[model samples]
Target: MMLTSAAQAIGLFIATNIDDIIVLSLFFARGAGRPGTTSRILAGQYLGFAGILAAAVLVSLGAGAFLPEAAIPYFGLIPLVLGLWAAWQAWRDDDDDDDDAKVAGKAVAVWTVAAVTFANGGDNIGVYVPVFLNVGPAATAAYCVVFLVLVAALVVAARFVATRPGIDEVLERWEHILFPVVLIGLGLVILYSGGAFGL
Candidate 1:
């Protein structure tokens, strides 16, 4: 029974965090070799996921969700605005500097990645709220522990993938184009999934 609960928690965490791993990979790809960047990304991921779980636990504790469904989609604006800003910066600074310097722009912020992770977690809240409600407190605690452990593992795995030779080279080469497009595309996807634009 304990193993079953643990398995359920693992599945839930994995389902909600696949995109997070991708986002982390993007961050790692962009921030590779930069001092302090990895720590910032890892911290941001934890902080952001903590926020997601906190929101879920609090909302579930309230015995219901407080945020209206429509408002959930509006959360996409966070990444949307960040992406546009990144795009503008990239456009403005098409310089003669090396790729490392070029890609090093402002992605090192812990809060920035945290915000992106949280923004990306709107769906996570939706998914977790119901599970938290159904599974009771002990199970929820177990899930949270499993989720946090998996977070570290996920970060390591993503970083490893991003830093791999061929993969790292390609990611480094295309980070400028890839970065903003990914964030914007993620935002649009979030919005679209929520029917935010009626499309």
Candidate 2:
């Protein structure tokens, strides 16, 4: 059961971090095989994700203590609505996250990367809070471990993607459609189960 829950946690991590992959790819491209860039970005990503997780856990703790069980599921709407909006924007060729990521510009440092990671993750906090609340302590612990491990995997994947030319066209063509679908699926599951995979 614990192993199953740990495996299921990957979906939550992916759902919450839909845009981060593209952003990380761009940053990796900016690195252009520069020294220390990869290390800095990895540190920043971990630091930023840690911040998000910490904040979500705290908020979940408070909400779990005070909120009724039935109400907690409604928080799934956070991801659902964001997914819809992202889909709409992507459909219209108007995803501005690329623009936002570009503002990170030529300067790539740990703090800069961390700031971008945290700022971009703001919306994820809403989705995470309720998921954490309903997942129970044991499952949440498993999720944290799983999620932290996946962060490194995501970074490596993004860096690999950066090395590939014309990947943007592929990403542009399907990234939004794919990830938002997952987000929407995850949201519905949370709404239905009040946790992931029935916890």
Candidate 3:
């Protein structure tokens, strides 16, 4: 049971994430491909995710609460829309540099990224609910630890690829493909949980 729950946690986490490469590329583009800035952004992203994990733990422990059971279906609806929107953004993107321009013109600070990342992850809290409630505390802790390590590794890899001279262009050209795949998977999960397939 623990093994299956941990695997489910890891799989769901990976399947639902699109911000990984998006944020990594944004930092690299803005930081002039510097490793330090990429790392800082990566750190910030992980910190944001950590905050979500802590919140989930509290929710699971009942120190905090989730939306009412009656509201869960609607909460589930949000990620479906968000996923489709992200996919559309990926498909319509003209220039990767536009993100940098938006960031600079808007003067979006680092803390803003942290806050947005955290908020963006809110829909993902659903992924932890079943595992936390069913798998027991040890399994939950293991799931969280494994998720943290995987996210760290992914961030490091994204930073490395973003810093590479030619890879940035390749990633930029192909992100439309990758982003939609992730988004679609997230959407499907939400739909399934909402009883679209009677699961």
Per-model CA lDDT versus the true structure: 0.84, 0.67, 0.60
Q: lDDT tens digits, residues 1-199, model 2? A: 8767876788878887866776677566555535777898899899988977876787787844444444556655655665576567656755545655533333356865565566556556777777778888878777888988999998988888866768744543445565456556645755666653355
Q: Which ten residues in a row have the lowest lDDT in candidate 1?
A: 98-107
Model 2: per-residue Cα lDDT at residue 114 = 67
Off by over 4 Å in 3: 1-6, 33-35, 66-110, 164-199
- Candidate topping TM-score: 1
Off by over 4 Å in 1: 63-66, 96-100, 103-107, 197-199
Return the lDDT, model 1, position 97.
64
RMSD (Å) of each candidate, 1 decimal: 1.9, 9.1, 6.8
Instruction: Give the Cα error of residue 7 in candidate 3, in Å.
Output: 3.1
Kindly indicate the candidate among 2 and 3 with the higher lDDT.
2
Instruction: Give the best candidate by lDDT.
Output: 1
Clashing pairs in 1: none
Winner on TM-score (2 vs 3): 2
Report clashes for each candidate as comma-separated counts.
0, 0, 0
Candidate 1 residue lDDT tens string, 150-172: 98888898888888889888877
TM-score, every prediction:
0.92, 0.61, 0.58
